[model samples]
Target: MSKEQQIHGLRPIIEAIENGEEISKIYFLKEGNGVLFNELKHKAKQANIATSYVPEEKLYKLTKENHQGAVAKLSPVKFADLEIILETTDMTANPIFLLLDGITDVGNYGAIIRTAECTGVTAIVVSEKGSAPINATTVKTSAGAVFNIPICKVNHLKDAIYLMQAYDIALVGANEKASESVFESELNKPIGIIMGSEDRGINPSTLKILDQQIKLPLKGTIGSLNVSVACGAILFEAIRQRMF
Candidate 1:
């Protein structure tokens, strides 16, 4: 589907799903509530659809009309689950996946996936709701790398991380505010990195549960790097350490 065809909102999206139209995922504001919304979520779960809960600004961008604080977009491709991706063989070894906590910008999402494919990361996991829509913009931004990479959608990013931890995988979360540095950390084992959206970094609840929270070195005045660039830098470092 065309990127422009990706419409987002509470009522419109839920109706689409009820009518049996395929949707990539639905985004709900953190404080949002209603019978319709609740029913939609229940149905989506029953249908094995992914859901993401995010802050307010994200819903505003999809449309100015009465979006009711929600946005729905169609993913050009389907997303898989972390466990399934991990179990699959012959694709890649020493699996490395990226989980975006609540990134909503299409460009950043695409760029990260591009870097993931380029750096040999096995798959990218995005929370069913808050991540960018795998629309034409994302496809274009990714330079078609989205097609080559395996992107999965999970019910909750935390549960997905827990699944990895259960498998003996180590998690590395990046935040400008984090004390530890990524360059100094050990990432040779099966790994997953959690990245936050533009407005806020990873959720504190998620951060508190991670194995390691590492920060990228920033000598500049801004003291922050775009999430995509930060992910590429970290993923490449892992590739370098593994290759050599």
Candidate 2:
């Protein structure tokens, strides 16, 4: 973590949040207690910023400067507003949106972004929490594709899903147990495809709300594929459908 990528001290962090900065996450000392710290916590919660309480040692490792028991990691790229993209994008072109559910690995997230951009996805959406931070490593893994694509962070994945539905874009999720295969699903129209974390396929609540669920057929003994690989397969299948 570079000093340029982090904002140290409680006051600076609070000011950054007030200024609508794209903060990836914040670390706070477990033992720290003060009026300003409480105010910071309130503002962070209101902004839906991911935060963690850690030991002072963790803060020291993050930065040698006087952190005042707080440090915030800044995102490498600015996040796009989901509602704005929804309103401005041409739905007639069958724009495809990729929604990530609980994807915490920066490498996988980056690879997914690279694949999405290559496949002509309109944007990528993630939850404000549990999703991977768009850090330096993510930028490298993405091959600089992160900046090329619009990534929207929402307070909750469900909220984004509902908003997409309001836009009349079909919502589908990638699930191994889904009855329909990705190749067979209707991806020729404007759609939002949900990809879950590597460990958990998809949240049960999230899976229930999707307009449809899709799976990639597997002949080998492997039960499932990597999230990024599955995303590529599904996205390309969508492209194939739209092209023909």
Q: Which has the greatest TM-score?
A: 2
**Model 2 lowest lDDT segment of ten:** 181-190
Candidate 1, clashing residue pairs?
A: 8-72, 51-129, 52-129
**Candidate topping lDDT:** 2
Which digits, one per residue and each the tens of the lDDT, describe model 1 over residues 1-244?
Answer: 4436666666677787788665776777788889877776777777666667888777666666676756676667755656777677333356687889998998998888889889887888887666667878899999999889888777788998888888777888988888878878887778888888888899989998999888988888996888888888899888877877
lDDT of each structure? 0.79, 0.94
Candidate 2 lDDT, tens digit per residue, 1-244?
A: 8999999999999999999999999999999989999999999999999999999999999999999989999998999999999999999999999999999999999999999999999999999889999999999989999999999998899999999999999999999999998877889999999999999878999999999999999999989898999999999999999889
Q: Predict model 1's lDDT versus the native.
A: 0.79
TM-score each candidate. Answer: 0.75, 0.98
Q: Candidate 2 regions off by >4 Å? A: none
Give the TM-score comparing model 1 with the true structure, all chains together: 0.75
